[model samples]
Target: MVGWLIDAIKKDYQPPISKVKVGKFNDYVQREYDFDKLEKKLLGWE
Candidate 1:
């Protein structure tokens, strides 16, 4: 297990999000999401 971990650490670990191409994630220019509704849904209030 230690040897495997060392080998894995030597390699470049690409996350799942690395494959996805997207625009500026934090850019709030056009107002894409309804954050109020999303918050309500997350809190089980919707």
Candidate 2:
């Protein structure tokens, strides 16, 4: 449908920007303890 519309309109329609993939776990931290500030905050650390 989009291709047909583009062809009919004869206009260059730029597709939407691609999304950033973050679920691959490539940049994920395996150790939760590394986030000491968050752990402390959750533990009621002032």
lDDT of each: 0.81, 0.76
TM-score of 2: 0.25
Kindly list the per-residue Cα lDDT of model 2 for residues 11-39, writing each as its tens digit.
Answer: 67677899987587577666646578878
| Clashing residue pairs, backbone N/CA/C < 3 A, model 2 | none
- Name the lDDT of candidate 1: 0.81
- Superposed model 1: Cα runs more than 4 Å off: 1-31
Candidate 2: regions farther than 4 A off: 1-34
lDDT of 1 at 32: 84
Model 2, clash count? Answer: 0
The per-residue C-alpha lDDT of model 1 at residue 41 equals 98
Clashes of each: 0, 0
